[model samples]
Target: MSRYGPRPFFPGLAAALLAASVTAAPAVVTDPTAVTVALAAPVAAGMAPNCATPPALARSVSAVPWPQQRYAPERLHPLATGAGVTVAVVDSGVDRRHPQLAGRVLGGTDLLDPGGDGTRDCVGHGTGVASIIAAVPHDGSGLRGLAPAARILPVRVSEQQVVDGQGTGRTVAPDDFARAIRWAVDNNADVVNLSVVLYADHTAVRDAVGYALARDVVVVAAVGNLHGNGDPRPYPAAYEGVLGVGAIGADGVRADFSQVGSYVDLVAPGSDVLMAAPGQGHHRAEGTSYATPFVAATAALLREYHPELSAEEVAGRLKSTADPAPGNGYGAGVLNPYRAITETTGGAVARSAPVIALADDRPDPALVAQQNRRADARQRAVLLATVGGVVVVGIVLVALVVPRGARRRWRPADPN
Candidate 1:
């Protein structure tokens, strides 16, 4: 997905970011007594440095048993499984036969061809992306989505793709994408995930996205993956009221190529992150493209919990409570499922005391300097003490020689 990244400006949040890296971090609490914030900046330890084409999936690992996988949809399973919510995915296409996503999908439209074949996974990318939103762990193998009960409305725009010199792959046309968006809205999808990015200047695409928003459908679009200057003018993301998401890595750092700007709304795990693929396999992909589904999944969960919530409300909950990252550029930081499901995200209100965590994303130059200065002072004090002790010893040695005769006279007079 190649679009634009939102670099939201919040001077007040900087303090919270500073506080997050320090001692005894609390659960994303806004108000607490004396949370120790490390004045030092955070290191982008595990983040992908720049936008690179997301690599193909690693050789399939033995499928993880259903009970022991990280992507197991435990917290969300009991609530609703997004049973009543339908999410539309505008991308390559999905493989309904994939074990993890079996039987959960609802009907969808295909814009790539005249035939009705939205379930085909020509690129395997759509299957992977859709499964990540609603995959069921089959027979204790493969990955499950956060909201597996939710249904996928897969809309394909391309047969396959070839990644050009730029980070994005080319296959889908912009006109097809616009048509897909309208189809999603017409089909009553509560959330629409756009995982494809193509270059086109058309108002119809914006109108499609806006149409979904007016109907209270969440239009989640990836902020594209062009890392440096290859970024085109803002597309569906820049359109008002659409939720634009960026791609970050497992390190909780922003991907270098996921476009960054004032329009970006949030980010999630996108780099080397594993999800279901076509042909009974699993793999990792990069870019804001892959990350948008995670947000859509969260929206599905929210709609499941509170069917009364509008798209704006669901979006607010996601962004407000999202996990705070120091350098994460948006109103919300990283998209965290555990927090989002429980309504524990710190973005709920303007924090009074500031949330403190040990996982800050910036470097604290002042803190480093203080530590160095303290060490230097301690060394100087120790040196002075050692010198004073040595001088006292030398005086005692010299006095011992002179004092004997004088001491004898003074002592004898006293005795007499």
Candidate 2:
């Protein structure tokens, strides 16, 4: 598959991101060109070896990423920090050693390796996605997840890696993907984020999504990054209950590679998006896969703020509160985390007004009657006041005119 990397935020960072090579432990990317490996799926995890060779470590970046400045998730801390919410990351494994993710990740299930929890990341993709949703904030580092207090349940299902210019990694089969989702839901995950995308829709995957929805779990998936490659709809994004996400750049427009379709329910900052690497430091990447986490993170905030809300209600709240961005495949709009948590859904907050759909332009009969009553009362009061004022003026005029006429009654008034 032919894939392109996203442009860097600054001209100087461009060379570092698109570098020819990098060196690190067995779990990171080696060739910088292969960092976009998130888009390529070559082998199945079921057929591949249990162990994975790490690629190169991600490059260190100190500057605050654009997504952080745009979303300003910190403002939502007073309202909701995703407390008591569990978000399952159904992607590559998450590295528990990251300082930002410490104490926030749960001992999740790893379908690839049953002996260990889902904390080990081989491709570094899952680690980045996890950080975006729940990485804790630290000094000297502007990078932090949207819901820092939310617990992460890592469901390691893919060990995808890139060797040389081609794709060589172990990803889960369609059946395994379904099992992964079911495992997350069964493990009591409030929200499930699927950064992984499959081109074809599988019956097992569809059924799994339905199962999650039935269990009242908010499921989010990427719409895929194959806009240039025929723009095929990806599953389980196209699945009925999934919140399909697309990628947007700093300009708040759709990323060039993000797929477009009715399946897309929302868009998020994905182009040149910053993420925590498997071991240490941060790097920039882009794709609908990256965008999926933003919505998932917002779901976590909603779940925390409104524990009474169902999975579908949380999803609906997000869609209804998003900033309006019309057409060109920009879903409902950019994900607004602060509004998602603070906005009222006719619940305790008492914020968002009810949207009454009018079948016709005519006014409501009850409201019209109420307005008519108010108008009639006002008209009666005004008429009485007008009559009183006219009577007073007439009496004053008659008194003045009659006195003046009496003074001039004896003879004709002098013409002066």
Candidate 3:
């Protein structure tokens, strides 16, 4: 009865139903690019004025006990505190006036609103992420970042919509997302932290990531929080060559809300993560978005210690040195900053790899084309295989059932 062919009642009907179910997976919903701010709970008010002197801020943070003992960056700080490394935070702007981030933030562009200040964090999400990566705790406050000495370059790509002290919606256009990444690479960012996620895979975004990798710029992204939906690969986290980071708790177990996927490359403490919030106070936040900066800051440390290592090599070192844990969601394992900083690689430098280029960076058109062709071919092959399988199964079922149906129709009624 179907347009494709006549329907069979026995085996053919079963085969058709099987094929339909096989292809009935839920349609992928492509949500707009947005900042991943999970839970922001104001724990305590550290100081009267948030913009205190470095010494005062340190004193305030030192009074807190959890952040210092949790990740324990002090063990590796003596070796390298991410000196001379520039980390670009591409998210909802950063609070340049935050006491912990004073004098560390560099000039960055605001792609969402041109001519606007990128350092002014209205949503507070970006500031939290930045503080966790490079906030100086030397003055004594408990709010110490992974790489205290590293410089932060704040690139604002998403506009945060805050309602009742919580970020309700943070959205960025695909083009703006791509532009912010390219801008970071062009500005010589040593490590770029993307604490936002786009549900759809935009080519412009992928190209920008490729461009960063080619220029030896380390790109780290959050693997996204599960928004009630099943795990979906988030971009630029899911993009090739990006270092995707998932969230773990203080107990070293994966956070329940952290999205699991093959693209996840590292895990860090995200639950009850104490960091600087806007208005000079400290907040305990949760999400993979918070976990990503830890990895980015660690990348900055590795870059500082091993300046000779390529971007890929820096990523490899992080993966190789991670504390081994089980699960595709956990990637190689939980981030081991101590081992990452101190471990020696037998004094061998990584081999030189081809660099991807931006528009102004002498891009190779032929190489880009070849890579695209390969990706296209692979996609086409998958499609062909799926369709071929359905057709083959249908034909076999028809062959088996046609003769049996004929026998049943031709059989004499007297036999009954």
Candidate 4:
């Protein structure tokens, strides 16, 4: 299939493809080409996946801590652990009964299936994302989130289906997604986390995000992971005034599959992240979907610590304090949550930057070129290494299959 081809209607295919290509290197293309190609794809919504599996219970062990290198929650816990802040996770439903999220999740609505409450999650995606934001550690079995003391408001915008005992996955209509964001804003959510990607930019969604911004609500979204195909500017993330987040691995570099663009406000740990799954267990997931909550949780802490800062100011602080890196894709840089919370603002006022209505948030030309060059070089190196390893393995296999005498005869000719 082409990079921007129509997504498979069968949710299983989408999920399987996502899992298989979690680490695939993205193809570098000019902004215009990427945007045009991505626009050709059908407008549908689905969860971005690094990798996922069925929720199953695992044995409890001693306090198994999250990788501090990825997210050092302990460092900031002393100052502010998102106290008095409410983060709205807009995605599939969350498992309220999950051990990690039991007391933290507040009442929310299910826009997808109005008959059911938003407390139960059919697929574990929402729960996993929520856990990354506010899962409370209990008895050392559960993992602690970036803002453990923060409250979670689970707003279910998508519905998951189970066919033949396997999760078929979920989808959210643009209207529903828009409604969910508006609802979160109306409910006084301090931060809104959108983990899903919509192929098209719907007016409703954009307006909803604007409304949230007007109310000083910090909106964080995952820049879509399309296996490096096409432009990664998926909605809500593509919308102006929203903090678009990308994924970086433990190496502190952008993930090969992470979408790169100017809209990427910041990046956080996304690969092999251990989070709470649906059935009271934990799972390691990857994708920009997982990266978003770290930023959202950080926003909660920022809002809690500096209630005086506006949403724009909080976003500016994050950008201003981010670690500088090579590309426009990395945005300001990787997130420094501690610096964002503790550093003095120096009395700088937040400025209203121009909000581009276009889908591709146009990045600086020089920076884009540089980022593309670096990405291309890295991908080439990885490709060469893979090829070399394969060739060596093939040679070994051939040698093993050949007789001893044949192997000796096949030795390289001696050149004097």
Best by TM-score: 2
lDDT of 1: 0.59
Higher-scoring candidate on lDDT, 1 or 4:
4
Error of 3 at 47 (Å): 16
Error of 4 at 344 (Å): 1.3
**TM-score of every model?**
0.64, 0.72, 0.70, 0.70
What is the alpha-carbon lDDT of model 2 when measured against the actual structure?
A: 0.69
Q: Rank the candidates by lDDT, best first.
A: 2, 3, 4, 1
Task: Please tell me which predicted candidate would have the highest lDDT against the true structure.
Answer: 2
lDDT of 1 at 414: 54
- Off by more than 4 A, model 2: 1-52, 345-416
Candidate 4 weakest ten by summed lDDT: 1-10
User: Whole-model lDDT, candidate 3?
Assistant: 0.67
Better of 2 and 3 by TM-score: 2
> Candidate 4: lDDT of 261?
76
- The per-residue C-alpha lDDT of model 2 at residue 340 equals 82
lDDT of 2 at 302: 86
**What is candidate 4's lDDT per residue for 1-416, written digit by digit as tens?**
10111111112222211111122333343442122111111111222232243334444334544444445777888988998899998866777777778788999988766765567665566777888888886775637888988999988765443333222444555666678887887776888988766555667777788777766678898886664566545666777788888877777778676787767878877776777766566666567878888889888998788766667788888877777765657887888888888887523334457443324355534334535755776799899999999999999987776777585776657896
